[model samples]
Target chain A: MSSTWLAEAFAVFGKDWRSEMRARHSVATLVLFALTTLIIASLALGPIGASPGERSEVVAALLWILLLFAAAAGLPRAFVHEEESRTAAALRLAARPSAVFAGKLLWVASLLAALEAIATPLAVALFDLEVASPLGLLAALAGGGLGLAAATTVLAAIVAQGRGATTLFAALAFPLLVPLAVLAVAATRSALLGGEAGPVLLQLLLYDGSIVVAGFLLFPVIWNP
Target chain B: MRATSLSFSGVSRRFGRVAVLRGAAGEVAAGGLLAVRGPNGSGKSTLLRCLAGLLAIERGEIRAREEGRELATADRRRRIGFLAPDLALYEELSVAENVELFARLRGVAPEPGLAIARRFALPAGRPWGALSSGMRQRLRWAWALLHAPRLLLLDEPFQNLDAEGEATARALLDEHLASGGLAVAASPVSLPLPRITGELDLAR
Candidate 1:
């Protein structure tokens, strides 16, 4: 990332993350949701004696589904700071739209990262599943969570200025997110089943890069007046 | 380039087969106040949106002088002050907070105008869009003016103003022009006050 890239990303993300810290809703809500989800997964997939591969598959899928919703839960106000206050218009007026996109991705990345930290450990503990390479789970999480944040934030901004923002957000996001869901689940399954992560991590990086480029091109088109 | 001016050359815009504006062209120069005259459905607002970069142009170019070079779209927007009828205000924030947000977004310093003293002060406590028209109008003007924009575009600026309100509105325009700026106002009819440099009859 260029220096301006980080600068702009931090500036935009700083606004929401600060509020989220003060509001405590993003962390508090996702953590509680993850906890309840873990309990449910624990009970439903009970006994820990099931075949490790089966446990790994189900755990991977369940873990992802929970994290996906947690990430989506925070998507509503993605670019809402700009929408709600005319600040968005000012943001357009003030800086390049590329800067705004970078900043927003940063915010969404951090939010998703926080949620990942909360969910990943609980996922392993609750499911009685083995983490093949602790490092693999870490890589899957750091890569996957940020990818989810970056992609979701762009979609959120697209919906932020619309008439039925939240409803439309989910609808627009679902189709675009199929690829991400596949990649995240695959990576996690590999992690839990003790497979090599180099390839999976490469896929995750490609996913992130594609989104970063797509977002860079499309955001200014959608974000501005 | 001049200090402030907006010109649309053969500017035409359409959505599918629905033409909002065509062959629409005009000029408003620095210290020149122009009023765009048109009735409903005449594309007055659409024209301003094009100037503000909120709407894209279809056929022609919009040129606003920028540091001795003619710039278009977002470049024009950076120097122009735009006030749309459908005002977008951040409601969750306080009055001063909203203003400060815009000011900071423009990378400018803060200026607090008394959050304590009650009457006739900046509308600090009220939620955005939750105030009287005059107050909302004041906030709109403040947001656009926060960056000391060179070109100001007002759409139906006097929409809900009464006799006294109209007087105040004209005074604000006069004050703005006194400082070597440009203003293009779109309205239904002419007001009695002075300082209009030109008129674009969009009704034709």
Candidate 2:
């Protein structure tokens, strides 16, 4: 990207971050939802009670599900709030469509990364997850978080234009995110089990890249239309 | 540098099964103003939005030109400043931050925006949500002119303004026109403009 484009995108990102800091909409929702879900999962599963094999398998799937649903709870607010407050038109006029997308993507990615930073360690401790490859786990979370953010950012823009936005966001996002969820769960499982996680990590990275490219390609139409 | 001009013809727009604007045509040369007069729900805002490239027309063409060269969509958007009732800045942000955000996005210096804010007597530290309606309207004017756009599209420009705010808006509009900036303003009532090059009555 050109320097001007990068500057514009960063401006957008900075604006969103500042606004979010004041509003605390996505952050509050994401943290509350993730924490509540984690508590319920810990209570239901009763920490480390499951066999070693089942612990990795169940915790891996549950962790991704928790993260995905928690992200959904908050991320849609990024675009939906703009429409609700009627600020989208001003933003649309002021910034390029791609820059807006990149900015929102950055904001969403940062939110997810923060969520992972908190939720992942808690999950590992709560579930007694055996992390055989710390690097592999980090890679999985980073790649998976980015992919989730990319998908949610564009989908949020699409959902913002229509009614029943929350329902619509979940309905659309779940189906599209299932593949990412599957890949994330597999990667986490492999990492926990000390298995070869390189292939799965690569797949997650490819998925993140694809979603980001597609988001850039499709956001203009979704944003402007 | 020659001034920019905007012209549109055979424009038609619809929402679902209902048509809003049909065959709407008007032109505003550089240093000219075009008033769009209509009743509520008469598609005055719709037409201005179409001209601003915020809304797409089902038929006809809207063209913006500079120095006799037709500008593309991106160029037109960049050169156009738009304000409407539904358009808003971030409520959580202070006036300075809002202006700075838009200035950066438009790739302009924030000093001009700050100057405009000062002219409007807006409190630099006041959050948008805390501002009164009149204050909000003044801030909107500051934002619209901050980028020094060549073309201005305003919908109901005088809606929430008190006499002082209205005068400020009128002065800004006049200054913009005097600088060879093209403007299209939509209002249900009579506009305060001193001179109108043409008018498009969308109610008809």
TM-score for each of the candidates:
0.82, 0.96
Worst 10 contiguous positions by lDDT, candidate 1 chain B: B112-121
lDDT of 2 at B100: 88
**Candidate 2 - CAPRI tier?**
medium
DockQ of each: 0.24, 0.58
Clashes of 2: 0
- Candidate 1 lDDT over A1-225, as tens digits, reads 022444545556666665566556467887888899889878876865678789889877887788788767766566764676555655665556787788778877877777777777777776667788787878888778878887787888888877788788788778767677788888888888887668878989899888888888899888875
Deviation in Å, model 1, residue B185 alpha carbon: 1.0
Would you list the C-alpha lDDT of every candidate in the order shown? 0.73, 0.86
Q: Write the per-residue lDDT of candidate 2 for residues B14-110, one digit (tens) a residue.
A: 9999999889999989998999999988999889888877788899998898767788776677668887877789999999999988888888889
- Quote model 2's TM-score: 0.96
